[model samples]
Target chain A: IIGMMAMTLSSVAADHLPSWNEGATKRAIIEFVENVTEEGSPGFVPPSERIAVFDNDGTLWSEAPLPFQAAFAFDEVKRRVPTEPALAADPMVKAMLDGDIGKLLEGKHHDGLMRILALTHAGMTTDEFDRRVNQWAESASHPRFKRPYLELTYQPMQELLDYLRSHQFECFIVSGGGADFMRVWSERVYEIPPQNVVGSTAQVRYEMRDGKPVLIKTLDQLFVDDKEGKPVGIHQFIGRRPIACFGNSDGDQAMLEYTTIGNPHPSFGLIVHHTDAEREYAYDEKPPASGKLTTALEAAAARGWTVVDMKRDWNQIWSNPDAASN
Target chain B: IIGMMAMTLSSVAADHLPSWNEGATKRAIIEFVENVTEEGSPGFVPPSERIAVFDNDGTLWSEAPLPFQAAFAFDEVKRRVPTEPALAADPMVKAMLDGDIGKLLEGKHHDGLMRILALTHAGMTTDEFDRRVNQWAESASHPRFKRPYLELTYQPMQELLDYLRSHQFECFIVSGGGADFMRVWSERVYEIPPQNVVGSTAQVRYEMRDGKPVLIKTLDQLFVDDKEGKPVGIHQFIGRRPIACFGNSDGDQAMLEYTTIGNPHPSFGLIVHHTDAEREYAYDEKPPASGKLTTALEAAAARGWTVVDMKRDWNQIWSNPDAASN
Candidate 1:
């Protein structure tokens, strides 16, 4: 009877992975979950040790046209240039106003992009920034989808998050996006609490202003939680190695490697390959805007990582595909 | 009937706060817990926002001889000096070897202390560092207490932690100590998980070494979680404002202020005053080592923060005061 219950519980088509089609990618994910969560299995991990990490932009939500955070910074720069005409002196400001992503992402560190971000995101009280983000999120909609960026999150990934959480896996969003930016709506949109977010951080100082403590976000010491920084951020924030890793770009390659490679516990790694051009935007050869999945996508096969061909594996795209209601 | 049960559950003389004597301090703590945990009360806080932060060193355990991390670093520096004789060239290393607390704590940022920490704590893989901490903890005993450091945790404070946790409060150790040091044994000792620890962090870099992903602990970005840095660390790591703050010394003053003042929720702040010389070490005019509770103590009355007079308030000290069994 116990065995029957366990079998019934572990089935792939048991309404657990509804957004996920009956395919190898889904099977691989379910098999790994079962192996780690089943009681007394050789690969069984205690709930406390079960950590799963996800990249935000391309992995959890839509990044096309432009990543939501980049769009926010760009929009902010465009808004600020008129009032602070001095900001127009920088070529980055012009690039931002024109929505020239290629020019913004040119430099190695993306210095132009960072400059625009500094102008918009820093030199303000944390509360003010939070309020701004909250207000912006309410008004901002995706260019293509014509829905709030929060509503554009991948349905399959959200279901995966729920499924993993049901088995007691602590899910953390390890993203290149600013921690402050993502924290504004991560709880409401993703069910991921603010504390669980590991992202890029700015040099924020604590000050007592008018008998009130305020965190002042400064324009210095930006810790970009991208590429190699992902694992470093995970170490600094989470203080443990994640057993499961999910990502969509070359930026997340290090995180995936850190989570699965040579881990003592049974580990799982998945890559979301943007192959759905109809329902969602997809590229022929390379991801145009943000997630250029070259080296990581190539290395996934040898590493035994499950690569989800979005068109083939996912039955649905966004949770609220119809943009109007959402 | 519900009120009777609630009254019965909240009484200070009950089994919950057994280590605490019948006094105003105990009643105050119990009252705050009752107010926050009781549903439908004006002071009732949702479980998700019931974040209670504790300072690790003086608040949780003894820090008389030196902080545990400093002790670890000093010991490590001594161990390394034998192999690398050039390490003695640095004056800070000499001060560490001599255990001269005055010399170490002289500078503004405690430069000598930070130097010793960098020499011992950095330029190694995180895994190697964890192994060293585990090994050191097994053998390292307090000089005066003559017990393994972990056993020296205050029984009363431990009870407070357990009590708060029982009432659905998520407890975090926001300490002036190194995060890595606390993370190793926090769960076994204080029941605070590694993820819940907010402390000083060193710049760690992610690198691939021989087909394995490893985090290299670098000495560069040292975030000192002391004085004003405490609230900044909390903001960066926890990403939320705590409602309850438990701490000792001026290092915790900002944290207390941040937790209590201007907070929308009814907040609780407690200061652990080391007033017992026989049961525990106490200083008359000035604290001899680590915890110098001057500024914060003076301000506590106006802030309505509870001050625990250790000698008068507590009937017990260490959980395992007897060294041999523990």
Candidate 2:
């Protein structure tokens, strides 16, 4: 009896995903990892080819209340308006200052919101922009969680990153967020380097400023890495099709299709359904912020993609800061 | 006396750059590597921050008689013309077939040759293009060297790559060549992976063809990553300033400047001055094909960038296939 009890305790201690509940979603992740990692298995993928991509906002962290980037942009507009009074002249800036998200996202392509982003995100040197992002990341907090915004990254997903890395998988963040914004804190928060973050990019021109080289960020050519652009960004930056993809919204539909459809290697696609309204805001078609999820969620079952009910599958959402386990 | 001789032999064997002669250029490279890697040194850089970028084409391998990509493109035209004779009607195609090199490079931007590239390089699925590039790489040989074009990679530079990598520096190829073209053989030839090769890119559209995901290449949004574009590409792809830069032409000048000028980290910039007409093609203002060096060459002395005169700096041009050293 004692021996059996000892074995059970040891097995539980060995669990890589302690935050994940014992369910179909967890089992599927484990099964796929094993299938591809087993050397002689027909589904085996080499270490060099073990690429995994994850969406940022709703997938890795709470995108509710406001997409963190939008929040940052809005805050930026408010802060800069005092110094640069002309910034208030733009309706997008006025909308942002008024916290009018619906007005910002009125157009199908979100032209108003895009213009606001260009105002807040561009027209500075790359170094200066990087410094501003770092400053924001240091002081910003989630309005609801009241914790630092960077602390809101989901615990289960962080475990998944570590779990995948244990098997030599190179995990990348392929998000709809601004690349520069994510790259600022990605290395510290996710342990994923700047080069591994694929997101929307603005044109940066090379210049010689006062006898020194500088890269000036401009709004000239903006590449929005969302929906269809996800797959395109993956190819442009990563140059290889990922075998694993994780996401939450319609934005990731194309990426999921690109990862699993007719992939030569065994592929895994997982969708993080924000199903915990109490613990974390839950919505499918409509949400408090961006990340509308109807299309991807509807297609998940037909494609054999694992759908994780955030409330049911995850025992804990955010990582415990006190946990000794690395 | 025998013991002393063995010690001398072992000292010679310990040298990483067998192809490089004892010179100021070699000494500077060794000194920079030591300064950045030594733990207690003021110039020491963390392993993760040690990024070294090199140019492709004439910098890495021979681009003589005809640049390898041009040779491949011309061959591609010849091969496809029989099946699709419409390709022959284009003036660029006619110039290529006639070996009228002057007519092909008539425009300042090489617009004629670019059109030929778009025709040969696009309108195909990316996977099909990869297969074609692989096939070409397997069969292609250098016209002057009478060896596989891949084998024409400079031994000294290859040694330099290995040497830098040994000190934990992650090396990337920032080139004017096509990213898709170089990605096919970069990993095998230069030990730089596809993600590490930043270069010119044509637009790739993602589509579902017969229920299988495919990326189609197009000539739209053609990004010619040369001169100023190199720095922009590095920022977009690598997302940080590189500490070391290597190049052989004016096209690489901006990249070199972006790497070394006022960089936070201690930096090294090098230029390979081709002066060996017997063993390798030698040109500065004029060359067999492309890679003009006038601007960069004149700037090198004032900038304190090391310039390697191929005849004086290198003992060998190409790597010996039979060498035991990695």
Candidate 3:
């Protein structure tokens, strides 16, 4: 009995974390956690004072050619094209349907993609849109990876999130994707439920439908969840400055800037630079699709943000043990 | 040298928070940490999975008689009343000026309060309003407590926030007060900075003035942050469901409900019940300015939410230990 109890306690302690691979990322993470959590450590942050924010797309998961939501949108458009045969020939719709994601985004600025999103996503009820997104996510596979898009999530990132939470870090997903679309699977995938996800949204209208009140989407623009809008989104949604923030694109610059501003104790701001082409496609300055990552890199380096070199830091790419098995 | 080494090691272990008061609250908290953190724990949650949300008004501080912002409004109105003497003769204004908070709220519901808030808070430029709120907050004292209104914040709650944070909990303040107003001081009081505070607000218009664009508030109603609105606000702002929630009124019931709904793991909801009549005024099921405790109490009991009896559980009240001392 004594031996069993000892083993159980040791196992519990050992299981708290399999030791992290040694490197700057591990050191940074451990140092940050220790400073914030260890009471007498120079960086000892009180629990009430602990606040960490994360970007949803590239930082948390994969935002390769496009954000996962954009990919979902493309899949959705493809599925719905049969219902609207004219979309088969429509250049914009054709590009999406044919999976010519790069072509659809070719030479288009961020505003152009927003315009496409507005046209593609607007006029549908929030519920209908959510249902379509769920259906696509369930069935769709990434063209390059040949894995379900959800499986494309970065493994090391997942470990980091779990690590932070264990220490009392409140994590949040600040993204430029549609809030409704992200909310559906975030809880299951990231363990972040719908209420903790902040993203871009169209204005919603509260109306009576058959004597029942429902919040429906409208064509009117509410707020974009990118670039300068990121700070505003954090202000409007989370309502508190994050002591720590993580992101992978220029869109997250404002959020990182805002997070680091005037924080009294030690704070952290990390940028996940996609430097791995084999495990994951590597591109920066310009994304493969409509996503851009210029301003954040410039600001990150100047501001001393921790730029994560994926090729160097991570031994594992995705969470599936199958990746290693293969 | 050996004794000193032992002392240092003991201090390190002691600093790990093993000495927190032993009980359900401590156990629940520690168990949650272990589950989310300890890889072998049945509830072992990953780092990507750690997202926590908190209610601001009563959970983080005190919202007795009226919310802190409401008190700020009252004081602002009283200060400005001298500039508008003609309005001082008005019954509502007279009641406000006389410090008859009860009479001012007599027969007035939430709509009535909104009307007063609109009339008093709107029309002013955003900067003007913010300055006034800050000025009032700096000077105003609670009627009964006679402490700077902000100083009325509960110390134990602050400790709780720190405790959770030390464990890596991401804390936020979701309140029914104005977002801007709360943002001003929430950072200083709760250590939850401006970006994490979500609340009600008047519509803001973005425009250029003196060659620079600024967002200005309009009298138009934007959003309410109470009752059903709490959940809506959470959806619009935080965008993810919280694992833990805390509140003290009906306004927070929806938030708690939303937080616990369909959550599989051990989620927590806590209601701070003001039961001390001598140290703090106590009333439940009363109307108009009476602190909201009735619906919350029943719902909490039914849902197995933790109901904190202030008189019994708390060894201390308010951050200012010298208030009663003085």
List, residue by residue over B220-244, the lDDT tens digit for candidate 2. Answer: 7777789999999998888978999
The weakest ten consecutive residues by lDDT in model 1 chain A span: A317-326
TM-score per prediction, in order, is 0.94, 0.94, 0.62
Q: Output the worst ten-in-a-row residue range by lDDT, candidate 2 chain A.
A: A5-14
In candidate 1, the residue pairs with backbone N, CA or C atoms under 3 Å apart (3 or more residues apart, or in different chains) clash, namely none
TM-score of model 2's chain A, to 2 decimals? 0.92
Tens-digit lDDT string for candidate 3 (B220-254): 54677777777666556655456778888787877
Pitting candidate 1 against candidate 3, the one with the higher TM-score is 1
lDDT of 1 by residue, A1-326 (tens): 76886788677434778989887998898889888998877899998899999999989998997789977877677666787878888888887777676787797988877778888888899999998887778788888778887788998998898899988999999999999899988888888888999999976888999999999998666788999999999999989999999999999999999998989999999999998889997852477578998889889999988999999999899885432132
Lowest summed lDDT across 10 adjacent residues in model 1 chain B is found at B317-326
Off by over 4 Å in 3: A1-21, A84-116, A119-128, A207-213, A219-221, A299-301, A321-326, B1-139, B142-175, B183-197, B201-222, B226-231, B238-326
lDDT of 3 at B62: 67
CAPRI-style quality class for the chain A–B interface of candidate 2? medium
Rank by DockQ, highest first: 1, 2, 3
Give the winner by lDDT: 2 or 3: 2
